[model samples]
Target: MLNRLYFIFLLVPFLFLSCYDSNGDTEKSATLPIYQDTPYLQDYSVKYYFNSSVSPKKVFEDRNGVVQVLGKNGLYRTSAGQFLVDGTLIADNTYRPLKDKSLNGISLFQDQFVYVDDKAVLSNAWAGNLFLPHDLENANLLEPGSNFDFLISDGKELQFLSKDKAPWKGTVEDGNIIQIRYGHEANVFWILGKNSVSTFDASNNQIKTIKINNEATSFDVVGAKLYIGTQNGYFTVDSELNGKPSDLINKLPVPSITWIESIDEEIWFGSDEGAYRMDIDGDFNYYYGKRWLPGNKVVHISSGHEGRVHILTDNGLAQIHFDPMTLADKAAFYEKQVRDRHIRLGFNASLVDLKNGDVNSGRLDDSDNDGLWTSMYLASQVYRYKVTGNEEALKNCYESMEAMERLFTINDVPGFPSRSFERSGYIESLHDSDRWQHTDDPEWDWKSTTSSDEAIGHIFVYSVMAELLENDLRERAITLIDTLMGHIVKNDYYLVDFDGKPTTWGKWNPEYVNARPIMVGDRKINSSNIIAMLQTAYHFTQKEVYKEKAFDLMNNHGYFENLMRPMSEIGKAPEDADDWSKMLSEGWNHSDDEMYFLGYWGLYRYALNDTLKTKFKESIIDHWESERPEKDGAWNLLTAVCETQNFDLDEAAWYLREHPMDMRSWDVKNSHRKDLTFIEPNFRDQTTEEVLPPDERQVQRHNANMFRLDRTGGDGSEEYSAGDIWLLPYWLGRYLGVISEPRLNKE
Candidate 1:
């Protein structure tokens, strides 16, 4: 009988999973392997800066795959560590140094250097060969020929030199030449002018010129195809010199192309705004501003060492390195980042006021949402502990857990958690100093006016710990949950401060919650959060009062109807409503999205009954469907808890993979991108038809609008910690068994 009873208990979980699958049409499972790395190239940047007065004109890779930049003054070479080195001349047989002065042009033929001076095209290939000596006048550009030896241009005319054949000369038929490039596959020399393109067949010395719709700016040749760049956009020309209409290929983020090149079989466009690479899918990987480049004005581009892209701008040179990385590898990187500079007195902190994205030049500082942010980090550590069983993750949870405990004990209020606490005597430095209060301990001060956000965050992490932790940690988590909820229930659903008054945004009483129209997001969010809090409080403490209070609010106050309302019906308040309600409903509050998703953990996992659990799943799925367009990894991963078959697992991985490695809040601008489609302004603040990739926009947390395009006047002063923004969803996905373990050794 005992064995039969144990067998029956073992079948319960399988029965639950099977029954859960019946509710959805598709199976809710991960498509990727359970223990393999999804391989992709993770890009990071290395920058080389010269003196401020230097004007960089062109860039190319040397025979050894090192980068070399040519400027107005002379050529500069990149050292072993991407540092600037003075250019040196190659010596001849007599050990006489070749002159490096007035070197106007540079190129490569068969991996050997071929440079041009004022009088000749020179090379060190065969004991210093100087072809076309004194024949070329004022040569400024040089390119290797396909059928001949080399093609040299002087901004006005072109000269082709060969070792065994007579030199061929040509001039643009329609306009003065700007650039001349040799199409190796077609054995043709393509010429770009101010307003037209001309092709030269060196075999027959034939020239064909065609006028373009826009003023031509730059051009590149890849085999039989010639890409022509103009002032507004670009078009393609075939080997037969057939030009496509400009409008057919004009769609680009930045159309003012200044330089174009084919590097590693991929088309890279350099513009006045920034540089971008077109992938095989025709989508763009934009590299803009200080995050990826030293300057916006790109002058030239080349393929660098080990598949890196070297871009020379007006200010300096940037080499973007693409390294092979998996999602697990990225997580470890973020973990080190948080531990190195983002931890302050056991709380997750932001490094603000850095000079030029330097990690050492900044100081960790507190935020208004201290508890909320720390809770997210602590929850990440909790999930990390559960997934990998790493002792370090548990230690992280313990340390941040101590910080959360102190938030309650730092102040005189019994259960009120302070917004943040800092070393005393810095009151003047804190934002809104009026909210700061001194503790009895002279060494510390605590922030007041704590709101519902802190309350929900505290309960969310506490419940997670109470469910997943062991021994003393579990008991402490349950106790804290009861203490916080006890205070709220005693104060009539309000977070009362030391001044004996309810804090603004801390009210969840029926009078406060039910006053707003149902369309208001606050009404829905507040109702959803408080119910989840009470349910969590009851589940851990086994308190009858917590259970009774939750049912009372849900049954008597109609919170179920409010939270279960479809997202489509949510909009601006009725015209006749109160000013506060109208103000609250003016837009969709993204902060509310964070709070609601956080609250969903308890709302669904700790539901009072299976019937309520099913309804909670439906409500969660409804909200997740509305958030589908943003492709938010955290929201999608959180929605997976509802047992839905499709939660955009692929998009979640994309978000994780595409998130920028640099967490600094660099000034990024995407409004000038021609590829984005603008939309009519709405309450949700979605500016485009589709959201840009995470690396293309400004670095922001989950609460900010994903569609926000530009951050002007920024100086890269602040660097956000990835603990709350990135690690939370990543470790959560790991804990949920959707993301795989690291195939590469974690070491």
Candidate 2:
């Protein structure tokens, strides 16, 4: 129902729904600058709503140049950016006040406005009072063509009527007729009947039917070609491409066609699925439920003054306006856009649907690492709620927390988070090569033997929630953290699976972490993670055993030295080293950077005391200084949370802003751009001359190289969401007091 949009209440805090009016008179101006510097971007849209009971039947601009809308019950008038129903202002602009009116369609002729009521009464609106212009019968449709020349069809006959004379006629079958139009220059009139197209000379003499095949739903004449719209889709052909003027192989991207309108260099197709805009370049901008329309059921379209196009849908009336905006505003707008686009609500549950590009409008499926991504998204909201006291943000935090905590109960293993979870019978396995376990409950299945990444995520989210959420939720956070941390400590610092052995990457025993040389990134990262988890446990539970274990890893086993290694100090492993360690050290460990920074929040924030922070300060600054060159926004904000060094807030904002609005994981090519300066490729395979904007780089996670040259469409691309990537830093900035609120001055 249209009312659902009003109560979808937990939408992004920044997107305020303006009162929608069928009269096309919402006060939102599309001219607000998006970016303060770059004002050339013409990317802005506004949504309008009508009274729940008022659905638009037709819409047009009046002769006086004001927008007017015809609703199921009455006529709506637009004046001075407000819609008035029967001359009375309604409290909310979303619903236009309905009043009794006799007219439902309008036209202009010889300076006199013609209005047609449902009863087939034709009145001259400009004659000071309602008066019939001519005796009419079954005039259901108005063919408003030239000022003096037009035809009205009541099924069997087409009346060639004039403002001052009796109507003349031409015969046609009732239901078989589609539409008719007259060409001024050619001095001929054409009839687009369902089965065939027939033409006549200006004198009304039949001039034979054009050779044709399948029925044409609608058609437009431009020069020598006919643009045909059909149930099968759109086709274009020369007036007589062959002996039989068959439809060409061409088709629009939509499923079925209803109406076609051509505007300047663009062609618009209104279909059963939605509206499509194809530019001269053949690129398409599809409008569907989430982006522009409240629903995809488009009824009719009317091109209005300027670049605006009015779309009348079964739900309400809306207009699409194009205007210039700045890049900054564009960046801010996308946050709201991505939230609505990627968030999926189902069965009282919500999750960040990461692979939106893959699913499009379909339902979202769980990724192999749903918990990991949800942890990051959850952390961002935790920060937002703490900073802004926004109830919506807190609600989102609880929803994701509920999902994250499910990972523990999903399997028999006490605290092992599955690689992913899904309804039973959907798939046989999580990975083709890895074993997937079926839980005791027959309704669900979850992947087993989860790696340390899940463990780290559990600790991070739980630690943050424990501090930020109130009473009951805070107590719940403590339970999750203690259970996961207790599981690790109980299994000799490893994530034990259902089969009673440590998961491959979950091994954090001193033997494994200290087994590799300092040059291997894993040695440093694993050591850092275990210590952080131990410390976070101590902070939440105030357990003496957690602090003792952290000290044991730090002092006896040299985990402190391992954690303190500067990021730049690592290099290729020694030639004589083990095979696995050498292979790991062959290149910069970008994933280690992700794991290290993600762990940093708990490592430093919940440190046992001030002295440890003072001792760890240099290591933190050095690591950030080395990472500053890459300009990773997520890492920078995590580093800023340590509060021991200066952060590049502008650069962080740039990374978030420069992140592309088009989150589709399409293959992007920036290596060939003339604007790029060539530079030597790095070990991580980044080939850009310099950091091209975030939009041009390979679709990435916080773990991937930010400046990597090419983005592989869906292949070699990680399943990621703009929400987690954006939310991570945006909330971090908020927590750091850098970004207070979005600068969208006018909602």
- The model with the greatest TM-score is 1
Clashing residue pairs for model 2: 20-49, 20-94, 34-326, 34-329, 35-326, 35-327, 35-328, 35-329, 698-711
**Candidate 1 RMSD to the real structure:** 8.8
lDDT of 1 by residue, 239-327 (tens): 57775633536679899899988887789999999999887688888999988888899998887666678888887878777766677
Residue 485, candidate 1: Cα error in Å is 0.8
How much is the lDDT of residue 457 in candidate 1? Answer: 91
Candidate number achieving the greatest lDDT relative to the actual structure: 1
In model 1, pairs of residues that clash are none
TM-score of candidate 1 to 2 decimals: 0.91
Report each candidate's C-alpha RMSD, comma-separated, in the order given.
Answer: 8.8, 13.5
Q: What are the models' TM-scores? A: 0.91, 0.57
Global local distance difference test of model 1: 0.80
CA displacement after TM-score superposition, residue 217 of candidate 1 (Å)? 1.2
Model 2 TM-score, all chains together:
0.57
